[model samples]
Target: MTTLRPERYSATAIALHWAIALLLLFQIGLGWALEDLPKGAAQFAGYQFHKSVGITILLLSLVRLAVRLFRPRPEPVKDGRAQMLLASAVHGLLYAVMIGGPITGWIIVSTAKVRLQTMLFGKIPWPDLPVGQGFHEPAEVLHGALGTIGIILIGLHVAGALYHHFKREDVIGRMLPGAMKSHGVIGIAALVAIALGIGALICGRLLSFAPANLVTPPIPLPSASSEGDIAAPMESTAPEEPTAVVSESAVSSATATPWKLEKGGRLAFTAEYNGEAIKGSFSRWDATIVFDPEDLPGSSISVTIDLASVESGDSQRDDMLRSDSFFAVGTHPTAQFVSSSIRAAGEGRYVAKGTLLLHGQRKPLTVRFSLNIDGSRATASGNATLQRLAFGVGEAEWSATDQLRDAVGVDFNLKAVKKAR
Candidate 1:
């Protein structure tokens, strides 16, 4: 019992409406598809897309609602009052729910306090909103709940449409596009939707990569106590000549305190992948240390660790990680970190910038460590986050869309005591 004319909708209107709807459905599918992915780069990218698309859907839905509102459409007088009210309510709820869902997601992502960037393949960056970190947990809860509810709402809408088409069949023809009546029109629109969908997927993949587009190369931020709070760059402004001097005063008395590795030292380390935390320990570590507080500036250091003694207690992970694929223990066993510059980060902490020769890839990195001295021993322990690809490890498992990042949370907790000379 349809009274309205069966004329076609404006091409622009129809195109926009279908495009938005299809995208929303695709987003839901993506969310579910990636729900259990391991948490490093791939998951980070997924969540980034989820949040960005959520925001996009919310905005587009609002615009569509407004169009439906200010731009009046002819009413179907033949449809029952129940049908009209139901449709109105459903659309109204969809608009409201879609808008709220992404806002909650954005707040949650902001609050996670994870300074993670989203890069798939293309170069899209997710803009972070100003966040008050204390509310992270609350925001996360709302984000999860609202998204679930919104999905349910969307599912109901689709289910109802199918019910009308298959079960009720009272007015399936009304909701169907006018193009459905013409074989030619139907084929063309179908072709168009498919083409557009494919083109968008390609664009979506192409638009998510973020490079190290840093405005400023990350330097050691100044401490409150540093004179004039100057950020000393790692590289000296003055070029080094081959004739750098080794003074008699520098050679004979470079280090006031004796330097040698301490016994019974412990170093604990932890790694984070995709949100899960994994820990490891190195009980036997040798370090040469100097503790003349006045000669702290001239102090140099080296650490030699036993590759044979690494045990995070999980043999499977330990063995697999130690294999040729990861560390390649049989050929090149031990991992060494040698430090050159030991600058005070203040607050009893120090940033050691040096080369971490891991898996034979010597990458320059800054390892920040804390110090404590008791009678004969001092220890420095902290963690650094770096991309795994930088060191040329784990090559087989990399993809732009589903990549596992090498920038894991590599941490340390070292305990060292001086050995009797």
Candidate 2:
């Protein structure tokens, strides 16, 4: 009058168990693949996939735990107390890692100094844990340690399963999809070997890789003189006091005598991060200048810079600069500088009082430059110091001046030819 207890796992339990297992193996490979990839878009993508799979395993593990609590399971095989306890210990540790691994990973990302937003599979937004920077180091150490522990536990689990299947012929079928009676030891062993081989190959390649192209050329620092042209280098001299704020409407774009911007110019910036200098530059930009050294009142200059073109030698750092935490190029793709007035600072030096619009914020900027005019060409070289935080260039933890300094020095060298009037 009563139903009998099944000799194997329920269909639901079997499905969750195998699903989590396969994902875990794939996740391990992905983690290794990240190390093989260059520190650019490829590595970033691999990390995202790893995160997605980790989250998936975490969810599935929870479901499996719930099923274990509610659903009936198979009876233990008639192994001795010591062997049984050992088997139980391995299963318990496996579950711990299946759940703890993802939790620790999540913690690492959440408390990261950069504070980047986590997007699961690039679609669903995952929120960070409301933990402080203090937790970041501990979580990172634990996450890596757990990964090593998980690998060991997985090997033990597989060996134990194979032992039961081949020697005692008792408990192996309980979690198998079909509850089949037997599997060829050779076939199982070959599959295990292939997986291990692939894993080893990935690790080897990652360890041996030396990225030759990863080294981006250092930003060219302005020099005192170049060729026969009189090129002035960046001077520590400060510009004169600011004049009236330049209104957007008052900044005239149409200069009577416009100087065409020639190629071979550089616009670069330098900032300190963690006591190390980070130098980078914008590859694309346009400028409009109307100036007759004699007519200072009518002179005006405007520059449009592509924010997405920032290159800092490091691809990962470049990506971070483009993200919302820095330039937010998606929202503000370009930055602008409009001059309100220009005045002579020295015999060959000039200061252009203007406003710089960056990261959707506007702030006053003074550009101190040296101009040397030839028959039909002019070469100008100078530098400006900008407070990045004033324009919201760095958000979250980056807003702190200690790590990435607030004062970013901008250096520029421009060459132009007078228009044929």
Q: Give the alpha-carbon lDDT of every model.
A: 0.52, 0.68
User: Candidate 2: TM-score?
Assistant: 0.54
Minimal lDDT window, size 10, model 2: 221-230
Q: Cα-based RMSD of the predictions, in order?
A: 17.8, 10.7
Stretches off by above 4 angstroms in model 2 are 1-4, 36-38, 182-324, 327-421
Q: TM-score winner among the candidates?
A: 2
Candidate 1 segments exceeding 4 Å error: 1-8, 76-78, 117-126, 130-138, 162-178, 182-421
lDDT of 2: 0.68
